[model samples]
Structure formats: structure tokens, C-alpha cells
Target: MKILLIEDDLDLGNGVRIALADHGFDVVWVRQQEDALRQLDTGACELVLLDLGLPDGDGMRILVRLRHERQNLPVIILSARDALEDRLRGLDGGADDYLVKPFVLAELLSRVKALARRSYGFDGDMLEVRGLTLHVPTRRVMIGERTVELTASEYALLKLLMVRADRVVTRRLLEDEALPGAHENASNALDVHMGNLRRKIGEGFVRTVRGVGYVVDTAAPYKVGE
Candidate 1:
């Protein structure tokens, strides 16, 4: 999953960004409202974690604009405003969920799962492709009764392929989403991760299209000839 984090505090933003990344989310962090808008313009983020305060402008204004621009965007307010009115107003202003600062990371992750289910029908904490079961929250992958251990990069690549199962995921898309901030060495790095994941799972699990990208068949045993 990809998330847009629009928090201004350096410490808080960096912490949240790392936490989200550890949980398998490709996070794009922006402190100012303009940068947030620019990030949103790419239409790459699946969910948003918006703060109510920013240096350039009020995050509420950005929220208003975001709602107007992308009506169906799932936005969760992550702010220090904990009053009843503040929460109520944020909800009324098209926010899917609200989380006050000083909140538990687990709770925030849970809410993110809930919103993801509500928006995209993504299974909460679990994604299954054929017999391969991936527990998102725990970062565990299971094949039948056996647990498959995978490196972080390998897991990210597998997740990206399984999430878009049956569709052709381009190389550029994979680099940008699955291996964010590593474009300098992404070409060879992704190949290594992909090979590792395929070996751990099954070679037939992920189908590689020549000159394109990888794909997975969630509906059945993924066969290259099929």
C-alpha cells in the first residue's frame, strides 16, 4: 500500500514515515501544503494521512481542495486537535477517520486497515495469492503449512505483484512504488529481490513478461504458459 503523509513536524513525520514503511507502506512525506498537492497530483497514493497544521497554509484548506479534486480519496486526519468540535468538524469535512497525536501506532495501523477495506475492499492484514498467504501486519508469508521467510525488499516486490495480480505492472511503476528512493540502483536491485522471492515461493508464482514487468495469478496456480 502507498500512503501520503502530510505532517510538518520533522521528528513526527520521519518517525511515522519509517513506521509505515516497516509495515509495508510506500510513504510519500511532504511538510508543506503545496508539496502535498504536488504529491497528490501524481495520483499514486492509495490513502492519505493529513495533518491540520502546516507551515505554508492551513491543512484544512488543503483538505477542502483535496475533497474537491479527488472526491473519493480516503483521508485520515492526524492532528493534535482532540476536542469534540474539532473531531466532528474534520469528520464533517469529508475525512474518513481522525486520529489525534500522541496516539498508538497500532491503533493508527488498525484504522488504516479499516479505511483500506472500506475504500478498496483490500483484505485487512491479509492478502492471498493462490495458496500463498501474506499477513501484512506481521510481514509473514505462508505457503500451505510452511512459513516462507523473505527479505524486506523481496516482500515488497511480492506484495506489489500480488496486489495487482492478473494485471501487467510496468517496470517504472515497480521502481517508483515497490522500490521508492532507490532508483539509482533499482534495476539490478529489483532483479535480485524478484529472483529471491520466486525461489522462496515457486518459480511459477510470479510471471515475468519480457521487457515489461512481473505479475501474479491470484485466482489459481500461476503458470507462465497459461
Candidate 2:
């Protein structure tokens, strides 16, 4: 989904952006509070990763306005602020989740997924079909009797397919959700990722729909010749 990332540090911002992009999020990053406000006011972003410090003003000003205007918007504070009061202030100020600086990229991605899933009435940290399992909190995937490793992008793609099992996930939706905004424009990117995913998980795991999209049919039988 599209995320509004408001971090001012060049190093930190770029790191977060690349990491989130690898995990299949569309990140619209801004360094100043005003720019963040403009993006938020447009109401196009699905989530917010905010930093308390900004060039124009404290990010709290934007957070305050956000709480006032969009009470349901999901905001996660990614900040260097670790004081108890600071954490309390952010949570009390309408932040949905908070992560301190020097955190792991996987944890942040998991939190974003958990919050996004919860918004859609999914309550657990896991999704399972047959013997294939995905532990959302840990970003772990397991087959019936073995564990499988997936790259960040692969995991995102698999999650999208599994969660929407029993239906065809259109190419447009997959491209928008799993690919980085820039890379999604590339013609061969999706095919490459899908190929890698199928190779790792076995071709039986996901079914292609020719021109329509892909499907993870929970009840689909393993083809004899596949």
C-alpha cells in the first residue's frame, strides 16, 4: 500500500525507503512537515511513518492536525525519541505504532502489515492454508515439513496472493501493492519476481491465469504433469 514517510535524515530516510520498497510498499517520502501535511491533506496515502523532527517544525504539529482531521489514519512514529514520556506522547497523540531508531527493517515491515491487516478485520499474526504457513510477526514462511526462505519482495507477493486466496489477484493490483513505485514501471520486473517465487516454493504453490492475473487456490489440486 502507499505510505507517507516523513523523515528528515538523508541516511535514515533513504535506508527506510529502500527497505520498505524491498518489502513492497509504495513510499512517498518527505523531509519537511509542510510537505507531509500536503500529502496527508490529499488523503491518498494509506499509512504514515512519521519522525518527530522536521525542518519546518516539530512533526507533532502535523500529528496533531492529523488526529484532528483523520482520526482513523494509521500513523507509526519512527523516531530517535526513546524517553518514556516521548513514547507515551506519541501513542497518546494518535500514533498507531512506534519504532525507535536503530530498529530492524523486518520488524518495521511486520508492524505495517499487522496494522494494515487489522484494519481489514484480520486479527492474527499468521496466515495458513493447508501446510503452507506465514508468520506475520516474524516474517517466516514454512511448508508442510520444511522451512522456506523468501526475499522481502517474494514474501510480500506471497502474502498478497495467500490472503486473497480463492480469487484472482489482478496484475495491476499486484504491481501496485508488491512492486516499488519506480520498479513497477519496468515491464519485466513482475515476471522476474514471480519466476523466482515459483522456483523457490515449487510451481504448484501458485497458479497463473494467462492474461488475467495470478491465483493461490487453496483447494486447487496439484496437476499431474506440472
Candidate 3:
């Protein structure tokens, strides 16, 4: 799962990022509210860990704007404000969960897992389209009897495409969510990973829309003969 972390605390952010990554989560950490809002626009993150305090703007504003825009997106407010009113406002403002700062990482992870399970839906965290099965908790992808081992980038890309199955996911959105900061590496980095993904999972599942982007067709056959 990909999580967007909007936090300004250097030490805490780093710790959270490392912890999430260690547990097989793709995390995009941004300190500034502007950057966080930009990332949110990309629709890359499945969950958000929003800090109520930010350097550029109030985190509440971001949360408010997010609720206005993406109503169903899961948001967990990580704030030092533990007052009843603050928690009430956060929940009333569409945040799925809230965690007070100086809390244990284990607790945070627990909340994240619980939210992911509830929000992502059914089959115990499995996302299935045709014969492709992506196990969210384990970060495992399988086709028929074969287990496909994917790199972090590959897995991220596949998850995004699958989550938005049958919908055209633009190239820019894919990069922002899956590749993160990989745009600087190579112009065709997305293509390379995508090509590998198609080969591993077999053909006809992911289709290119020429100048547009890619889509995972739920009705497409598992594998088309060469």
C-alpha cells in the first residue's frame, strides 16, 4: 500500500517513513503543505498520515480541502492536539482515524492496517481482477499457480493499476504514485517497469491507450497467446 505522509518534523517523519517502508509500504513523505496537497492531487496515495501542524499552512486546511475533494480517501491525523474537541473535529471532518504524537510506532501501524483492511475491501485485503490476485497485507501478487516476485516499484505500479482497474490511469498519475521521485532517473522508467510487469503477469491484462495511459481491464483474459 502507498501512504502519503504530510509532516514537517524531521526526526518523526524519517522514523515513520522508515518504519512504513520496512513493513512493505510505499511512503511518500513531504514536509510542506503545498507539496502534500500536490501529492494528494495525483491520487497516488491510498492512505494519508496528515500532521495538523505544518510550516507553510495549517494541516486542518489541507484536511478540509481533502474532504471537499476526495470524500472517501482515508486520512489519519497525527497531531499533538489531544483535546476532545480536536479529535471530534477531526473525525467530523472526515478523518478515518487520529493518532496523537509521541505515540508508539506499533500503534500507528496497527491503525494503518485496520484502516487499510476496512477501506480497501473484501477477500481479506486481496485485490483480484481476472486471475491476478494482489494480497495487500503481504504485498504478494499471484497469477494462477505462479507467484510473481516484484520489486517495490513494480509492486506499487501494479497495485495502483489494479486498484483503479478498468479505468485509464494517466502516465503522470502513475509516476507520482508508484515511482515517486523516479522521474529524474530516466524518461522511460515507468515504461521499463510496466513492460516487466506485463511480461511477468502475462499479456492482455494491461492495455496501452497510446498517448493517454494504461488500464487494467477486468474483463480481459488472463493470458493471450503470442
The candidate that achieves the highest TM-score relative to the unseen native structure: 3
- Stretches of candidate 1 above 4 Å error? 120-125, 135-157, 164-172, 178-226
TM-score (all chains, Cα) for each model: 0.64, 0.55, 0.73
Which 10-residue window of candidate 3 scores lowest in summed lDDT? 117-126
Q: Candidate 1's error at 190, in angstroms?
A: 11
Residues 47-110, candidate 2: write the lDDT tens digits. 8999997888988888899899988778999989999999999999999998999799878888
Clashing pairs in 1: none
User: Would you list the clashing residue pairs of candidate 2?
Assistant: none
Look at candidate 1 and tell me the lDDT of residue 37: 91
As a TM-score, model 1 comes out at: 0.64
Candidate 2 C-alpha RMSD relative to the actual structure = 8.2
Worst 10 residues of 1 by lDDT: 117-126
Give the per-residue lDDT digits (tens) of candidate 3, residues 1-226.
Answer: 6789999999999999998877667789999999998998877778899999899988999989988998878899999999999999999988999899899998898888788767653222678888889987798899977899999999989888887676688988888768877666658989999999998999878999899899988786555673
Q: Model 3, residue 98: what's the lDDT?
A: 88
Better of 2 and 3 by TM-score: 3
Residue-pair clashes per prediction, in order, are 0, 0, 0
